[model samples]
Target: MNPQSADAGDRTTGRYKQKREAILNAAARLFDENGIKGTMLSEVAQQVGLSTNSITYYFKKKEDLVFECLMHTTSTISAIAAESAAGATPEERVTRFVTGRWKKLAEAAEGQYPAMMSFRDVGELDASYTKTIFSAYGDMFRRVRGLLAQGPVTSDNRMSLTIRTHLLLTSTQWTRTWLSNFSVTDYGRLAAYMCDVLINGLLAPGKPWAPTALDEKVAAIKLPEPSNRNFIAAAISLLNEVGYNGASIDRISARLSVTKGSFYHHIPSKDDLFAECVSRTLAVVEGMQAAAIAGEGSGGDKLAALARSLVGFHFSPRGPLLRMTAWTELSNLEQFYGQVQPMRQLTQTVVDFLATGMMDGSVRPTHQAIAAWMVVGAINGSATLDKWVPGSEKTDAVELYLKPFFCGICSE
Candidate 1:
C-alpha cells in the first residue's frame, strides 16, 4: 500500500477508538446514576451525540457495553496496583496504590469515565463473560492483599487479610458516590487524607482503646422481636435479591410462606413496609451510636465499638435488612423522606463523634466529615462480608474488618 493510504487508515482507526471510548464513558455515567436496568442504549447515544445504531456498531449488545465498561475499570485498577509493585516497603506500596487510584479516579471524573463503575448487573451477562470479569476483579483483589501481607501491619491469618482488603477496596469504591456530589479541586490532598485515615486511623497515638462491653441490654436493641420481625426480614431479603421495584408485597409474602392477606395484616402497604424497614435499620444504628457514645471510653473507642456493632449486625438474621435498607431506593416511595431523616441524623452523629475525638485528641486531626463518610460507607459495604468470606466468626470478622480503618496496618 502507498504511504498516504496507510497513514489515512491509521487516522481512521484512531478516531474509531476515541468514539468507542466516548460511548463507554457515557454509558458508565448513566449506569451509575440510573442503574443498568434503568438505563437505555439510546440515552447513552444521546449523551455521546451519536445514534443507537452507532453504539451498536461498536458494542453489538447492551450487555457487551456494560461488560467492557466493568472490565475497563477493573483493568485500570489492576494496572494501578501493578504500578506500585516497585515500592521499597509494604507501607509505601499500599499508600502509593491507594493514592494513585484516587488521583486517576479524580482525573477520570472530569471526562467521560465516571469515578465509579458498577458491576451490579454482571450476573446477567453470559457465563464465560462473567467469569472473565470476576477473574479480573480477583486479580486486583489479590494484588492488594499481597501488598498488605508484605506490609508489617497485616497478619498471616486468611480471615484478617480478606477483611482488611475488602474494607480498604470498598471504602475507595464508595468514594464514587461521594465524588459525584462534591467537587474535588485537589486529588492529591484528597488521596493523602484518605490514605492517612485508612493507614493510620482517626485515632490519635497513645490514646487508650478498649472494646465496648456487649451485654443483653445492648443486644436487645436490635430489630423488633420475632413476631413482627418476619415481615421486615423477608422484605429486606427480597429487596437485596430483587431491588426495590421487584420486591413487591406478594413476593415478600411468598418468601415468608404467608398469604397476601396475612401480609396486609402485618404491614399496611409496600411503601409502609419499606418505611418500617428503614425505621428499624435506623433504630438499630442509633442504638449502636447511643451505646458507643454512652460508654466511658475515648472517642476512638466509641468509633471502634460502633464499627464492630454494625459489622456484627451484618452477620445476624436481620443483617440483610440493615444492608438492604442502606442501599434501598427510598426516593421513589411516597412519604419516605420522613423515614430518611434518621439517616441524616446518623451522619450528624458520626460527624459529631469524629469531631469529639478530634477535640479530645483521641482521633487524628483530619477532615471529620469525609472520615465520617468513609466510616459509614465501610459499614454499609459490609453487607457482602458473608459472601466474601463464608463462615467467618462474628467476633473475628468484626475485628479484622475494622482493623484497617481504626488501628491501620502501620499502627498495628
Candidate 2:
C-alpha cells in the first residue's frame, strides 16, 4: 500500500514480462527448427534458465504457448502487408512488402529481434487453437491478396491473383530456408533480386511457359503413387496433412482401414516409416529432375518442365509428396544427417540446372543458387495451395500455380 512497495511491485512485474518474452523467443526458434509438435516446454525453459513449472505461470499449456507464438508471427506479417498497401500500384506494393519483410528478417537474424516461426506447422496445432489461428491467418492472407488487386474481382482474374498471392507469400516464407547462406547485410540485395525475379521472372524476355512432359519418365521411376491403396500411399497423404509427429502409426493404419499390427508388419517403426517416406519423396524429386534434364528442350524449357512436374505432382492425384517440412522431424542427429545429405545434393542439382539455363540464354542471368533455392521453396511450399486457392487440387497446376513463378506475377 506504500509508494516504495508499489515501486518494488512494478520492478517485479517488468522482470516477469522480460522473462516471459525470453521464453517466447526461445520457443519460437525451437519451433522453427523442430516444429511445434516436436518442441518441448522443458527445452524452452532450459533456454531461458527457468524451470518447466515456471513456464506454466506464463502459458498454461504447450498449445497456449504455440498459439501465442503463431499469432505473433501472423500479426507481424499482416502488419507488413497492411503497410505495403500504401504503394500506388500492385507491383510497387509487392516490392515494398517483400523488401520490408526482408529488412525485418535481416534484423532478426542479426539478433535485433526475436526470431519468427513459419506457418508450415500451424495445421498441427491443437484443435481448440486452430480456429483462432486460422482466422488470423486468413486475415493476413486477404491483406496480402489486397496488394495484388486494384480493380473489381472477376471470375477470370480472381484465380490468377489468388495463385499469385500464394506464390508471393510462399516465396517470402521460403527465404527462411536459404537466407542463412548470406551475410545479414546482403539481405537487402537478396530482397531486391527476389523482387526482380518475381516481377520479371527467370526466363529471358519473350519466353513462353511451354514444358516438356515428365509423365513417361515419372512412370518409369517406380515409386508409390498417391492414388494407390497402399501403406506408403496413405502414410504420405497423412504426413502431408498433419506433419511428421502428428502422423502416428495409429492414424496411418486407420486411414488405410487396417490395424496397428498391419502397420508394424509393413513398417518396422515410426522412424522407419518416416525414413521410407523421405526416401520415396527424394526419389520422386530426383526422378523428376532427371526426367527434365533428359528431355528434349532448352534449359528454360527443362526448368519449366521440372517446376511443372514437381508442382503438378503435389496438386495431382499422383502427388502430395511427403511435405518437405516433415523431413525436419527426424530427431536422431545421425539419421537426420544421413537422410538430409541426399536432399542437399538435390538442391545442388537444381543449381546446376539453373546454370544450364543461363548458359543457353533461356533464363536470365541472376543468382543461380538463390534462384535454385527459390524454385525448390516454391514447390515445397505449395502444399498449402488448397487453403489459398480453394479447389486448387483440381485445377491445372501449371496455369494457376506454376505459371506465376515461371512467368512474372505481373505477366499478361
Candidate 3:
C-alpha cells in the first residue's frame, strides 16, 4: 500500500472509533432513561446526529448494541474490582473497589455506562450470547464475594454472601437514576459515604445489635383489600416475571384462572392493572413505615422493624410485588408517575428513620439521604429470596437477609 493511502485509512479508522463510542454513549443514556426495550436505533442515531443506516453500520442491531454496552460496563467494573483487590486490608479493598467503580462510571460521558440492565429478554438472544453475558455477571459476583469475604464479616455462609453482594451491587447500580443529578465534585464523597454505610452500617459502635421487638398486633397489620384484588395480584405476578411489555392481558387472566372477560370486567386495562399493583405494594410499605414510626425504640430500631417487615413480605404469597418494584419493571410502567408519591413517601420514611437514629446516636453519623436509599435498595434486592434460597423457612430468610445491613459485620 502507498504511504499516503495507509495514513488516510488510519484517520478514517480513528473517526469510526469516535463515532462508535458516541453511539454507545447515547444508547446507554437512552436505555437508562427509556429502558432497553423502549429505546430505538433511530433515536440513538438521532442523538448522535447520524442517520439510522450509518448507526447500523457500526452496531447492526439493537441487541448487538445492548450486548456491547452491557459487556463494556461489566468489563470495566471487573477490571476495577481486580485492581482494588490489591488493597492491604479487606476494608481498604472494599472501599477502593466501591469508590473506584463509581468514580470511573461518573467520569464516563453522560450515560456511557449501562448501569442497570434488564434480563427479561435474555432468552430471546442467541444461546451463546446469553451464556456469555451471564458468565460475565458471574465473574463480577465472584470478585465481589471475594472482597466481601476479606472484610470483617465472620459468617462465610453462601446465603450471607449472596445477600450482601446483591445489596452492594444494587445500591451502586441505582446511581444511574441519580448520578447525573450530582455534580462531579460530589461523586467521591457520595461513593465513600455509600461504601461506609454498606460496610459499617448505620449502627454506632457499642450499640448492641438486637432485633427490634415488634408487637404482634402492629406487625400483623395487612394491606387493605382493594376491589378486584385477585386480578391485580395476578397481574403483579405476571409483570414481575415477564416485565411490563411481556405481561399481556390474556396471560394475566390465565394466571388467575379467569377468562379475558373476567379480567376486563374487574380491570379496565393493563396500565390500570400495573398502577394498582404498584399501589398495592406501596400500601404495604406505607403500613410498615407507619408501624415503625409509631412503635419503635430508636431510629435504628424503627429501621430494623421496617427491614424485617419487608423481608418477611417477600416470603408471603404476595411476594411477587416485591420484584415488580424493581427499577427495571417500574421504569416501564405507564403509570409510573402515579406511584411516585408513594415511592417518595417510602424513601422519606427511611430517611426520617435514619435521621432519628443519627440524632439519637444509635446510627453512625453519615449522609442520611444516601443511607436511606441504600437501605431501600437492600430491601428491594431481597425480592430475590426465592431464587437465592429456595425452600428456606421465612424466619431464617428474614434473619439472614437483614443481618448484614442492620448489623454490620465488624465486631465491637
Candidate 4:
C-alpha cells in the first residue's frame, strides 16, 4: 500500500468510527430520557457538547436523529444478545435471551423508551427506517430459533417453532404494559415457570394439540356478536384504561358517554364484547404477520421482520385492549387459550423451525419439546414482567437474560 493511501485509510477508519459511535451514543441517551417528541436537536447536541448545526450535519433531520438513536439502543441490545448466545449451551442461551430482554425492558422503563417509540408510528415514519428496525428484531428471533431447532426437530417443524417463539416473545412484551402489581423479577419467574410447562407439553412424545378437539370446542361455544363497531370501540377504550377483567360492560358503556341501553342495542353480554376485542386484536396480529412474511427477505430475513412487527404490535396502544382481554379471558382458560392461540402460535413456529434445522443438520437434536416450551414460557413470562416491576428494576434488558436458557437447549 502507498504511504498516503495507508494514511488516508487509517484516518477514515479511526476518527470516523469514533465520531459516529459518539453521535449515536449521545442520541440514544437523550432519546431514551426525553423521548422523540420531548427531546430537540439542541438538547442532544448540548449533551454531546456539540452545536445544533454540528449535530444536524451528522443526522440531517430530527427524525434521522431519532432513528439513529433508536438504532443505537437496539443495536446495543443486539450486541448483548449475540455475545450471550455465543459458545453457550442450549439452556444457557435460553436463559441469557430471557435475562437480556428483561434488562432491555428495565432500561426502557427507566428511560421510558417505549414512550418515545409511541411518539410516532414507526412504519409510517419511513420505509427504510422501519426496515432497519424490523431487521434487528428478525435477527434476534432467527438466532433463538436456530438454537432451539437442534435434535428431533425437522425442517418443517423449525418453521413452526420459529413462529411460536416469536409469539411468546411478543406476548411477554404485551403483558408488561398492564402489569400493575407484578415485579420485573416476578415476570422472569413466570417466564421460567411457563418454560417448564411448555417443555413438558412439547417433549411429551406426541402432538399435544388436536385440531379435531379444537374444532369441536369451538363449535360447542356460542360465538359473540362483534359486528357492532360502536360496542367494539367502547370495549377497546375501557380495556385500554383499566385492563381486561377490570373493564365491565357497564364501564365500557359509561365511557362512551351513553346509556346501558345503547350498549345492549349492539351487544348482549360482556362475553360478546370480549369476543369482539379478541377478534379485532387477532386481526391486527394477522396483518402484522402477513406483512412480515410478504416483506422483502428469505426465511431468516422474514423471521427478523416478524419479530419487530410483533414487538410493535404488542407495545402499540391500539392493541392494549386485546392485551387486557387476554388477562381477563384467563378465567375462561379453555376459551382463553382457544382465543389467544394466536398469541401462543409463535411457540409452534419456533418448534417447526427447529425441525427444519434438524433436517438441514444445522441445529442439534438434544431435546425438542424441552427447547420449544422453554422458549415460549420464558417469553410469555418476560412479556408481563414490566407491568409488575417498578422503579429502577424495570427496563428493556429483560429479553437479554433469557438467552442462556436457549443456549442450554441448542445443539453444538
- Give the number of the best model, judged by lDDT: 2
The collision pairs in model 1 are 202-364
lDDT of 1 by residue, 1-412 (tens): 1112123444468677777778778888777665666678999999989988877777877878888788888888888788877787767877888888877776677773444475544554677677888888888878877667654433446567767777777777777756755665766777887887787777787764446463233445644554677788777666654456557677788899999999898788887787777777878877877777666665666776677777777667566535533343344644666666667676677788788888877888888878888888787767666545555645466666776677775443
- Overall local distance difference test of candidate 1: 0.70
Which tens-of-lDDT digit does each residue in 317-354 have in candidate 4?
33333442244323455665677678666656656545
Q: Name the candidate that leads on TM-score.
A: 2
TM-score of each: 0.84, 0.90, 0.84, 0.40
The better candidate by TM-score, 2 or 3, is 2
Flag regions of model 2 displaced more than 4 Å: 1-16, 213-229
Per-residue lDDT of candidate 3, residues 115-218 (tens digit): 33434444445665667887897798778766767445454465566666666666676665556567877888888888788778778877765565763433
Clashes of 1: 1
TM-score of 3: 0.84
